[model samples]
Target chain A: MNFIELTDQPIDVAKVLQSVSHPDAGGEVLFLGTTRQFTAYPDSKEQDRSGDAGGQHTAFLVYEAYREMALKQMERLAEQACQNWPLKSVALVHRLGKVMPQEASVAVAVSSPHREEAFQAAKWLIDSIKADVTIWKQENSPSEDAQWVHPTNSGAAHE
Target chain B: MIQIRLFAGATQLAGQSTVELSPTDLPTNPTVGDVANCLTARYPQLQSLAAKSRWAIGSEFVELDCPVESEHSLAMIPPVSGG
Candidate 1:
């Protein structure tokens, strides 16, 4: 059973793991991506060290996505990974809306005939999710200021 | 009319979830890039995000030169931050 879901509710890892459990699979890999307390943006202006460094204390994250697109992308990733690997089952879940720090935002679980394939598929799924998924997060400060997180260029700050 | 959905920073920059471009407002046949340009023209603040965003028709991503029609589902996909 391949599980693909996008929810505003907290992710149920037990169910995710259970979905990937198969008789033929000897190994299963589950990866949980949790929201961090602090978010440090990758500086594009690394050459100039005097600019505003982007290590901020993110109180929480507000996640939003193109819902239809996101689900389609998740389903596609699960299908592609299953075809690429000798896997038994897979589950991919991503959280939407407000997510607190230290909470699990994303989960990827895959079962395979061997540990190598499981690990590889799990990694690829997570990586692809980060790259192609339409989801975006807003970093909210302790004082409640919100800043949309995006890959920045030069030294300009996001509005 | 073709309503292009915007996400993430593009949404924030545009101050709206979607940008509406009427058929009469555009040329005879518009490409994905033309619609993108119309977006920036409509919302100047979205220049940076619009430039970086990828235009998608339905679930598949399309390049700038790809021809777009009003009936097709369109979306502006910003660089994703999801894990």
Candidate 2:
């Protein structure tokens, strides 16, 4: 069963893993992209704005998407993965809005007849999602300061 | 009028998620670049972000030179930072 979704609900990793399970498949790969804390670097606009700059932990994240477009892009990438590999099923999902640290913000799951293709497709899907998907995230610091992660600017350095 | 959807940093800078601008201010048969130009002219704050943004139509991204109609759904895609 191929399952795809964008939700504000918490991700169930087990459910994602189960979505791709099939009797014919010998391997199933699931990757969860979880949120993690980051330190605010010096001279960042985020730093200057918050005045709580150097080395503060991020408390949470707020994610956004051009919803319809994000879903379309996810579907396109999932279909592309299937075309490039031999897979039985696929599950791609992302969380939107406020997500606490250590939460799974994104999940990619795939099943294939063999181990090799399953691993390959799972990696490709996650990488492509990072590159092409319309999803975006903001870092909410412990001080409640929020800064959008712009891949081209300061956050790009930390990333 | 062409409607533009903005997100993340672009939305933050524009102070709104979406905006509609009359195409009358643009040249005849305006292209994606023209739309972008008109937007930046109206919201100069978007200029910096626009340097790295991508103009998209439907599910596919379009070049700045591509022609667009008022009815088309257009979006400005900023440098994405998703997991």
Candidate 3:
């Protein structure tokens, strides 16, 4: 079984866990994505737009998606995961609109009879969603300007 | 006319979410590549994203050479940044 949702409300991790939980499955993995407080603008000019040279703090993030295509792609990924692993259930949820700092924006849960398969499936699900889903995130800085983030460059600074 | 939907950076560059192209403006039974070429011709700013973007018919991604039916919805997808 699979559960896929694109919603404007915050992701409900508990509900996702409940949905993916199966009596026969001995292991389950859950991944949650939370909004970060700081983000650097890809372009230095955007930092100038904020007028604060020292630090560029993200005020919030606005997420948008090609909803129809996103759902279809997510479903396809879930099916692919099931085919590759000994999985019993999967749940994927993503939040749209404004997401505040430290709030849950995305959640994924997968269940399998063993820990290894569950771990692998969960990792694959999140990675595939990042690479394939038709969802976009625009970082809203303190200057009240929002810049669309590119997928390739979306990583932590220290990484 | 075939409607081309733009998303993410493509939408920002095009300055509009949707652009329409009449059948007369394209090759007969235009492939996705043909439609992409027409888009770049009309909106030169989109040229940079042409190679990076993926084309989707309805909800599924399609190859550049895939034929587009008149009634199908076409979307130009830039690299995704979702979690």
In DockQ terms, which candidate is top? 2
TM-score of every candidate's chain A: 0.88, 0.84, 0.86
Interface RMSD of structure candidate 1 (Å):
4.5
In candidate 3, stretches whose alpha carbon ends up further than 4 angstroms from where it belongs are A40-56, A152-159
Candidate 3 chain A has its poorest 10 consecutive residues by lDDT at: A150-159
User: By descending lDDT, how would the candidates be arranged?
Assistant: 3, 2, 1
Residues A1-159, candidate 3, lDDT per residue (tens digit)? 799999999887889999999999999999999887875455556445364455558899999899999999889989999999999999999999999999988898999999999999999899888877889888888889877776443322211
Q: Chain B, candidate 3: TM?
A: 0.95
- How far off is each candidate at the interface, as Cα RMSD in Å? 4.5, 3.3, 3.8
- TM-scores for all candidates? 0.91, 0.90, 0.88
Any runs in candidate 2 off by more than 4 Å, and if so which?
A39-56, A153-159
lDDT of 1 at A74: 92
Arrange candidates by TM-score, highest first: which order? 1, 2, 3
lDDT of 3 at B17: 95
Give a tens-digit lDDT track for model 2, residues B1-83.
Answer: 78889999899999999989787888999999999999999999999888778878885788899999989888998878788
